[model samples]
Target: MARAQRPGSPPPGGLSVQDQAPGDRRRDSWKDSWGPARARLTDLAEDYARLLASQDPAAAEATGLPSRTLLPDVGPEALAERNRVERRLHQLVRAVETPRSLTGNHGAKDDDARDSTPGDGDPWGRAPLAVRVLRAHLLERLGTSIDLIESADQGAELNILTSPFQGVRRRLITLPTDLPGSTSSVQDWADLVDRYRAAPRALTGIRDSLAVSAAQGVLPPRGQVEAVARQTDDLARILASQARGDLSGGGHAAPGGALGRDLQVAANDAAQAVSDLGRYLRGELAPLTPVREGVGPSRHACWVRRMLGTSIDTAEVYQWARQELVDVVAAQDALAAEVLGTGSRAGDLDAHLRADPSTGMSPEDFPRWAQGVADEAWDAVVGRLLDVPDGLGRPTVLLDTPGGGVHYEEPEPSRSLSGRVLRSFAVGDETVWPWAERTTVLHESVPGHHTHSGAQSLDPSLTLWQRYLGKVPGCNEGWALYAERLAIETGLLSKPADRFGWLAARRWRIVRVLVDLGVHSWLPVPAEIAALPGAGGGTQWDRPTVEAALRAHTVLGEGFLQFEVDKQLGWPAQGLAYMLGERVWLAGRERAQHRAEEVRKKLDLRAFHNRGIGLGSVGLDLLIRELG
Candidate 1:
């Protein structure tokens, strides 16, 4: 979708500071050839966005869910086609908007630049003719595509055509803190307020639209509307509190700082845009819609293509997830039985996991303990397990006292390529230790997301687009889960407590599959499934009737259930990524393992992983070839 820009035009989004390679002259030729096609693709994306905005008015009203479209159920081919369309859109944008221009004045500047950034893997290349033709159709429809989401009078809809994706551009900057020398931070409560002010107003519209849709009965019940409203309110309050120095210490919005605050504003705008656009689905635009049981396979495929940046049959992925769960659970159960005793049933193992005294560590020393665990894990990887990249700078692990889980934020492109793995301090029980600490380190730091992801981004051979933008969910999360298993192979799970912890983590993923299947596919959601005997009812949860509530809204759960339900409910396809990605990783690992005849050969696991990742954000089909 490369467009003709006035020569020396600033990059879209005021991101002018990031270093970028000059556009190749040969690429310009390809851009010229693809220009018409790219425009058509943009139209398709706009149409698809409108469809999403208006998907479910009744449900939106009842649950207050953002007026977003769900990915349609479809076969693989259609999904891939949709991806092509989006890729074209991104390519056109990138060709016109240089990355070097993304550095300043993100407020309005970034919005203008979003359509110009080549992203989601639609990089300039010598593509096939089919892609060229598809691009042409997309360009042809680009101008009128927005009409798909609107009524005769310009109302928005709730299908895959309208709400959430309407105003989407890859990166939304709410606060200005992302700029170097900016003092506003997500960590600072005051900066949070500033960021909210700058956030996109879409969310507010989304909330308001749902409320209206609910009252009109075009959306779901009041409960659903309330649920969404509550979420929106929570986000608003969180920003307000942080800004006012109520929840955390409020800090001044430093000069050139407050990007995080700005990001919040963008988030809000995204919400409002969704709601405003959702009006099409429940109101004037409903009559002309195609008749089906919700969005049919074709539409779902379109949605998947748009969201994932590739066309993937979500139903197929779900089937794969289901099978993987069966296999993983079966294998783990057998292992657990063997470890506990030959006669031990799952219940017995559960009892052991619950009653094991070693699992309990005092929470008061939690920060020191958590930091120590991260340090220990880091020690093993640095100059030992794998060659830590010298250019990665000094990696740091921090404890997040609130969220009680670990995640890593890689260094900004302007900063060193290092990363930070953070474990939330919110959950204070020592009972989560041994496994929690080990898995957190494995997943968040060494040999997991941070280490692998950081290195790849820093690799000089990779293009700026590939380095920073090549994030494939399957590869990223799948590799991390595989890394956890690798930790076990390296005896990282040596102690019983450690093993128990690993099992607990594994259980969490398994539960995600079950919950997603239960909620989305209309399967049964148990009130209480297998639990450790003395684990103190680890988070009482309401289990919905999956079949009865199919395409219906379910209340949020707490604890493990909370993660499972909330994620599955809010973001489709995310819950399945863990196991689905692990499946792909395990296949690659087994292949690599088979190739290495000697123990020493198999020992170079890092090499195998690096090879797999070097392929860049490709589909599973491409990954299979790369792994081979």
Candidate 2:
């Protein structure tokens, strides 16, 4: 996120001469505010997180489990808990807002203060950067959670799989290893068995909630319902395997003989619960689901806000996607011409590249292949592109999910374990090894998620709230998307084919942004790009149209394409987060770099990168406000 022409590295902390100027108020107050500001932020972060976790157990798992508690009952009970938390958040936000005044200056006499005394409304902005950002974060958190809950329609995101249930299931299974505080393996197994035993009862609450939601006319799209069923069915199989003594399912080795015997039986019961839920989703829920592919304006707006943490005009976003696609096409062509030489058909390059044997590794071989790629990506950027901290990424684990793509889990802030990439290298996506795997690796692992996420977890200056809860999609996903460009910029995409992979990777993002805007807003697909997806132009933004358009522009296989499409249907504007986030990050970098001279300062890439990541996990709006 930062770059400079410094002769060598500046210091141990990466602070420069300009940063430590004798009278530099910015640096001084930045130091001064660290204590009180951090304390307040930590309190805010912990309270908000605990409250949220009370409602959504998975959120707690993702945050280092300060309280190693299983989520309370699901369904309406959990929804009620969330409502209480939401109200509490509003009160907290009001309580913590820095009133319009300043007291003692923060660092130096002329330094920009953190906040003015309680009532003095001097023109200079009140509140420290951290406090302002924290307040905004609390607000953003409430918006995403409460708005989704408030807008509980049949198509709302409170369903069994993609909405919140799947996440809860994942956290529950991973608890023994993921939770802090080490217990003996036998004790851990017993604790896990207890949770396993409790799973069925816990699920009844969720199953009942789903029934009530359906009764109230709150249903999801039929296709999404089916997609979620596929996911639930997949998870059930994994649990069943674990119950039968396949340790891979639970990430726990069997204790053997009598001690492990009951583990298997308990796991069997858990698997039965999971399977029963899957049955409900497929046999009971799908028929009741609506067949519509798009959300109405109100729901769409909520999704946009939910994912991006900012609002944009949907009509403008659609046109922008179209224009962005045209540019992407041109850039790809230019790169292709450079790769293939003059008069060589650019589209042929794609055809030739797709035919490569390496693109079709069998599903059994994908974990090793993906793990190898993760290793290569880490080594490539560890020192060159990022100063990666110790104990970040581990050998990738191809965790079997319901329907899976590449997803990264950062090491918990506890540092007790290494980060593992869950690549549910599902078999349907042609050969699971698509060309974009490298870029995706970079996006999900080193120099992208692995490094960026590690920074978020490891930064000492960040409050626990910011650490556990602050990661907005825009700030983090934006960095990962920007990482793809960085890989290309650094000449990592050496071959024309590799460069094409980069293009294809980004091409899908552009397509996603367009599809999200189109499906939700029903923006009229422009004629210039109507045929843009494939041979015949697209007329409307529907499942087939978006799928064809994606296939036309990207190297994604059929199964992968379908997975992405169905997710887009259920998840809505979340598809836009990657590219939109990358755009913000890219622009923020340029904005800072370009304005460096105006501020009589030189940009520090390491500091810029470090600070950008260190701001914990706030949304892009706060990121731009602070970093810009």
Off by over 4 Å in 1: 1-225, 235-342, 350-359, 362-364, 370-388, 413-417, 425-431, 521-543, 546-560, 592-606
lDDT of 2 at 341: 77
How would you encode candidate 2's per-residue C-alpha lDDT over 535-582 as one tens digit per residue? 235455667677766677666557777767776766777888988888
Task: Report the C-alpha lDDT of model 1 over 1-628, residue by residue, as the tens digit.
Answer: 1122322445444434343334433333333444454444444444444332334332332223344332221112322343455455545633442223223323222211222223334332123222322332233233122222121111212322123322221112233344335565445534333333323443444434433433433332222222343444444454444343333434334323454445445345544543443343345434433321122233333323323334455556546555655565565567667778676654466567668667656555555665666566667665555554456654566655465456787665554434777666445344554444677677777667766676665654333333443345656677778778877877766776576567656656755655554443433334333242222232222233322222121212245344433344433345555665677778866776775765456536656565565444444434553454
lDDT of 1: 0.45
Using TM-score as the measure, the top candidate is 2
**Model 1 TM-score (2 dp):** 0.56
Model 1 poorest 10 in a row by lDDT: 147-156
RMSD of each: 13.8, 6.3
Tell me how far the alpha carbon of residue 541 in candidate 2 is from the true structure, in angstroms, after superposition: 3.2
Q: Rate the local accuracy (lDDT) of all candidates.
A: 0.45, 0.66
